[model samples]
Target chain A: MIEILKQGWHTTIQDLGRLGSQSFGVPISGAMDLNAFQWANKLLNNNSSAACLEMTSKGPELKFHEPSFIAFTGAIMQAFLNSKPVKMYKPIEVKKGDVLKFSSVTLGCRTYMAILGGFQSEKVLGCRSQYKGVTLEDRIVKENLLLFNRNAFTQKGARVKTKTTDYKDVNLKVYQGPEYHLLNSHSQNEFKTKQFTISPSNNRMGYRLNEKILQQLPEIWTAPTLPGTVQLTPDGTLIILMRDAQVTGGYSRILQLSDNALNLLAQKSTKDVIKFELITL
Target chain B: MNNKLPFTFFRMHPKVILLEWEQDPSTETLKELTHFKANILKYSMGVSQITLGYCSLLVQWKEDIINYSDAKKNLIALYSNLSINSTPAKTKHWTLPVCYEGEFALDLAHLSSELKLSKDTIIELHSKTIYTVYFIGFLPGFLYLDGLDSKLFFPRKKNPRLVIPKGAVAIGGKQTGIYPNESPGGWHIIGNTPISLFNTKNETPCFAKSGDTLSFYAVDEAEYQKIQCVNNPKAYLTKVK
Candidate 1:
């Protein structure tokens, strides 16, 4: 058992999201950065689908009740185990009664912490991801007792690390969306050349992009939308749907981001300038 | 643009493909889309998730490493191999109860004054029509219902309310929906439903499906409280046909 000594900003348990529930209008609530989420599990040799604690902006302080193993990845947050500093993307061992604390983050906006056998939580719709009405609680609060399986298997000593990203000058890769044909010829050419900034109105659902493009496209019939679908509103604002995005929408889907691009964009925050590089299929 | 194919398939992502119909959206088109969506899920294997909307169907695979070309071809093959006139699952007509008195009917006065209709007329017209459940979106259990009475048509709020209370049945333009969860919305709240539209504890979180039909019946505040107090509010559902 792990005790949550401190509550952080937007801390929630997420897996690959509540799958197979789109027909019911449930948002697929999952990790923002899938790359980091998978790596944390790989480091500890845990199941790839293991649930992890996703922390945004700030991180929580956790106290372990038993000997456990953990791996931290994403956003490069400052962390410590009993006053000694620890690095990200490494499997760290904790003795009983050890308190782990995490501070502010840089180079990104979100972080992931994966335990050895994964965090055990009530599964709603076959996923451990948390959502407002779908789950009992939207976030993990202070004084919340977290349950994790105590594994007996020992990890084979293996070295693994990925270069930390600065998230600067990175291009958000994309493909033309279903409604790409609706864009005028001039608008299509100009969209690629223009650089956009991430607006402050960004969250788990979507990132609203700044700077309007000159497209007066009418709303399409409500259609199915996914995490990486880039929708252009009538006023030309670009709204890129994220992990917790609704199942359907009524806007022009102009572009679809690659999985890798979605992961990279998750690290970005408001005011960050980004350019979309279209990878034609 | 492709006249030969009845529907066009676009690769939304490496592991996701969107099959969209060429026909304009209508009740008939929705029926066709429903048939196609069901068959794709039934015929295909290894499909993780499949969802349908106004005129399109999204098919997602379980495995990450998918050859998009093969997957798209398989989807296309599945579409052409079968006849489109397969029997669809029967749709349900749900007669849900709603209270229009006091706090529940926040916008009824404004609607009556704006549309020049009486408050009683507004409530009567809204409940009279059997609205079609076009699809569910925007929020969980928030049904995208159609067939709102034109007499009660009103534009959405210019500045949307930051928090529209859950179960607040409202109308916006030609569409009407219940705010299954408290959310920021522009729809005018005309009434509140006692029946819980969504409950995660239930095996099927939402009782209604895309092809289902819904209608609201006026209930007194006393009855609303009675139903709400019941541990299983959905048990009161009158599924007509």
Candidate 2:
């Protein structure tokens, strides 16, 4: 068992999200960044679907109750083990009594902390993901004992570099949705041409982009917005629905990002400029 | 563009066809569109899922089995056959139990004051009316029902609370919904339900599906416990029609 020594901002346990039900209004609450989560688990040689800790914007501090192997990926928060600085995106060894701490983050909004064996929680609806609203527990604070299988994975001990794919400069691919042509050709051209910055209010629910796509096309009706769905609000703002986003939205969906493009948005930090790319005809 | 006239569409997605009835759609139009989607799912193209909302039905399919061209042809054929008088083959009806008192309904008092009605009257008004499950979205098993009495309608909270417990029955604008699993929400919560809106262990996780009819029944604390604790499927005496 590993113990939480410090609780960071909005850290929670997440897996591939609760799927199998969308008609009932459940948003898939899984790892926001699939690539980062898979990579973190891969370092520990754990299953890709294993539940891991998700630290948002900032990270928390944990103390090992016993010897354990762990890895940190995604957001590059200055990490330290036992007061000595540790590298991001690589597995590190910690003995009993060693404390792991994270300072301010410089890039991205979320980080993944994966142990050799995934963390354990009381499963709800077959999912152990901590949806703060549903589970009633907000934060995993000090003295919280998180359990995992002791002998889950064989110790490789060899460190692997976290794959840092450059998506910041890449053009995000988008498919035309039902409301695509609702925006006249002028607005559609503007949407494809212009770059937009992620608004500061962005979180798991959705990312509100600071753009003027809405100024061109205004009329819309209530429609089901899927994950990766780009909704254009009346005020020219873009709300990109995330993992924990509402199952349905009322905004006109001008563009629906391909599943691949959604991976890029998960790593995007506030103020990072991103451009959209149309899928090849 | 004519304000009242519905815009026609030959195509929406690569395969999917758009059939619009009105800009601000009426319940009659939504029901008709849902029937059209249901008809398409029955014979040709096994559309994996069909999502019905206020004004549209999103039909998702397995692109591997059916290409865009075939899907477009089948969709237009189905749309032309649809008529305004068509009714769904089957409609699911549900009567959920609600404990609308004390901490269970934290926002009840505020809602009563805003709507200028007593808490009991609010409960009476809420339970007396039958609601249509217009759509299911926002969360799993979270049914968005229409037909709330206009007197009870209110705007969502400006600043949403961090957490609202599961089974919280809330109202926002003209729509009423029960939060299956708690997340940040701005709905006016007037009651609590003992029935689990979503249970992943079951074949169908969401208790109420689209095109289902929902009614609320008032209950006390003891009754709430009996219903909440009963995990056995057989113990749920309420028949889902």
Q: Per-candidate TM vs. native? A: 0.94, 0.77
Interface RMSD of each: 1.0, 3.3
- Residues A201-228 of candidate 1: C-alpha lDDT, one tens digit per residue: 9999899998887879999888999998
Q: What is the Cα-based lDDT of residue A176 in candidate 1?
A: 95
B9-41 per-residue lDDT for model 1 (tens digits): 787777787888876677766666666678778
For all the predictions, what are the DockQ values? 0.76, 0.42
Which parts of model 1 have CA positions greater than 4 angstroms off?
A156-166, B1-5, B64-77, B80-86, B231-241
lDDT of 1 at A184: 91
Q: Give me the candidate number with maximum lDDT.
A: 1
| Model 2 agreement with the true structure over A56-84: per-residue lDDT tens digits | 87888888887877888887788889889
lDDT against true structure, model 2: 0.74
